[model samples]
Target: MRRPLIGIALVAVMGIVVWQWPGSDAVASAGAPRAAIASQPVANHGNWLATPTADGKLTMVAGGQLVIDAELRRLFDFLLTDSAEKPIRQIKDNARKVLAERLAPGAANVAYTLFERYIAYRDALGNVKPAADATPARLADVVGRRNALRRQFFSEEEANGLFGEEERYDRFTLDRMAIEADVSKSAADKRAALEALENALPPALRQARREPVTHLVEADKAAELRAKGASDEDLFRWRSQEFGAAAASRLGELDREQAAWEARLDRFAAERNRIQADASLSAERKQQAILALQNSQFTTQEQLRLDAALALRARQ
Candidate 1:
């Protein structure tokens, strides 16, 4: 079975930082050292250090240098790099050391706990195996399991710090997925489900979700119409209504190009037939003529498509 389209939802949840969490101070303290308000900018390497606020909040210095320690930078590099070949155990160990060195006395443990949960969450997500007949309930169950793990591992404050806006977005996605997977529901019911989900999201995220949903729905409708032998003009109108004038115009150009290509293919087919039927041409001459015709008709990229189309036609 194909993997469910839950990756986007997962990314949305994991990528965001919960700035409003009550325990934000604990996490923030792990960041760069606070600079004094009037501290002179020090040029370290290529970066400039900024003066801290009166309350000791880290601020950018005049130069490009960040106030963060070298160890913190190294830690970030290790985490961000493609470590697919490296052992997970080694990475975790390195991460612990980095956090211990960089974070404040009490903050390091909280940060480390978040890191551990994140890694475990990812591993569990990878292992989820949906049933052959994937239903709304089955898919929801998978999401539920993930949520359960999250709840089990992190407190409300920790979740807020780690997930932030992503938490709501993920719930929104699961609700949307459940609606889509419910084959028992009518089209109207699915539409209602989706609308309700959108309405429930935060204003910014509501708009974000709406655009993709609209694009996908319209694109699917266009494909359906095309399969039913809709004209290019009809498709242009549909696309315009769905995606606005700019996208519609772009698609119209693609349609005209495709029509021109098909016409060229027809001409090539006629010429090839004439060459094949020529009684005066020797077998070697006929082969040479066909090769010459192919070279004249298509460039390398076009030739691949031309070959595939011809092969498909032959099969038909």
Candidate 2:
């Protein structure tokens, strides 16, 4: 197929705390000592609930009723932070306390068991590595092992709640990678593979994957046109045909911004050349003049671009 060397980022399933921006109601209720935890209207998709807390934050509710507590939140934060520095046993002990306080008598035991299994899954992933010339089968084997581990640790329903769509994502990625690596396959075959892979995905993820692929293909086409010295009009027409009016309009805006930036750079270069050629000025004075000119002409972002351009010119 001679497919492009596209980097596909594999999805990792981990238990992490999600933070959402505070809503108006949450903000208004903040600082109230005993604010009621309101159930936010979430889609009836699974055993999950969006419960708003008194501190203008939202926490996950498991089994659609059991509100996850501050201890669990603290544990999640600790696990995520690179600087946590606590030993594994200590971390587990702390998480146990949090889960114990939050969950019902029997439910707490199950939650703690699940927590331990989650940590084991993470550790297993860290230790797994395939060979340098690993085949599609090898990749599939790794994915299958991970899934098996999940199944061993948690029930099907529980697994789905903790790692939504992750298993499907792994399968999709593995299939795509295999297709990309098959040199004997035709472009049409590869396209078919891509279509099948995308079709298998849930709607939301399918759209997310498709948009980036579309953008990459369009960018490559644009680069080819640029190399062939196509006119701006020609580029606009091409983009419009490929991606539609909205994308073409956005590209036009970007082109105008770029042209303005280049014009300013040209002006700066001319002024800098003039300063350099002024024999009356000392070297230190010339440097100071250039600095002053740069400060006057460019905003922070523009200054960064100007500095990069100057560095590239110096290198050449």
Candidate 3:
């Protein structure tokens, strides 16, 4: 099977996005059954030509409860992409049309109702101000408030189904931060506490958290091997032995891309140093020369990151 070109993002310390929302006690009523055609066609729009990230299945469990999860969120986001550009009424109609096309009538109706409530909740959430402090206490307080607001719109089951995993992960992260920041704890105690926290997580969450760390460790080892004069074939064979042929191929591509990027940066730096060392040029002229050089070397978008890259280079 072909591997994905991009990898899933890994969680980092203080990297979780804080949800800000005001409280609301208005619960959305359950959707009622309505007669619908079996072959309902979606609205003819340019956006629907391609496959969506999520198919908007509106799946239910054996107990006749809706199964809410990240997939549902992805569907909602895909449908609501035009929210900023279009009026709410039109956007909702478009979403309903797509859902009706993809799902059974009863499920589509229920999904539509839930989508509306989600929109209302999100609207209220938009009014909340983000906390300036990134301290664990402040983050936890913000999460608590956001959950309170979420509960007012959804029942216990609904809220849990929709956001349980993310909430759990957030709590775990905050707890980890708190433990790491504790001044009195010895290094050994901190390690034990961190290990305990990791052990407490569900298997899926544990795996998710470990993947990025594993990748970083593997990358460092690969770099060491390369420093010892490992050839491309040697690296490929090593990576393949470790993580299958397909994954090794992808890693090889990544390695080449990184090498090419570094080469470009080196060339840029060499030319830059030469420009700076030219004694005949005035300060203004040198500045203009560097600006011209940057324009010639990088696109407008790439130029945005050039300063930060240069700063990091200087530190190194």
Compute each candidate's TM-score over C-alphas.
Answer: 0.42, 0.49, 0.65
The TM-score of predicted model 2 comes to 0.49
lDDT of 3: 0.64
Single out the weakest 10-residue window by summed lDDT for candidate 3: 36-45
lDDT of 2 by residue, 1-316 (tens): 1111232222212211111111100112222222111111111111111122222112335653433332332244344344247787887787678666655656667666666776666556544443223355655665566567667766777665554344555566667778877999999999998888778767755544454256567768888998999888999999888767766877767678877877888899999999999999999999999999999999877787777887776798
Regions of candidate 3 where Cα sits further than 4 Å from its true position: 1-66, 213-215, 256-316
Candidate 1 TM-score versus the reference: 0.42
Best by TM-score: 3
Which wins on TM-score, candidate 1 or candidate 2?
A: 2
Cα error, candidate 3, residue 60 (Å): 5.0
Q: Write the per-residue lDDT of candidate 3 for residues 93-210, one digit (tens) a residue.
A: 9889987876667777877887898888877765444444557776676567777878878788777766676678777878888988899999999999999998997776665454
Superposed model 2: Cα runs more than 4 Å off: 1-125, 145-155, 161-164, 176-206, 216-252, 309-316
Cα error of candidate 3 at position 32, Å: 44
Residue pairs whose backbone atoms clash in candidate 2? none
Whichever of 1 and 3 has more TM-score, that candidate is: 3
Q: How good is model 3 by TM-score?
A: 0.65
Cα lDDT of model 1 by residue, 1-316, tens digit: 0111111121111212221211111122223222111101111111011112111122223442323322222233345344577787887787778666655645566555556766665556545443223343553464455556656666665555344444465456556766777889999999998888778766655544443245457657878998999998899888878666776776677668877988888898899999999999999999999999999989988988887887776798
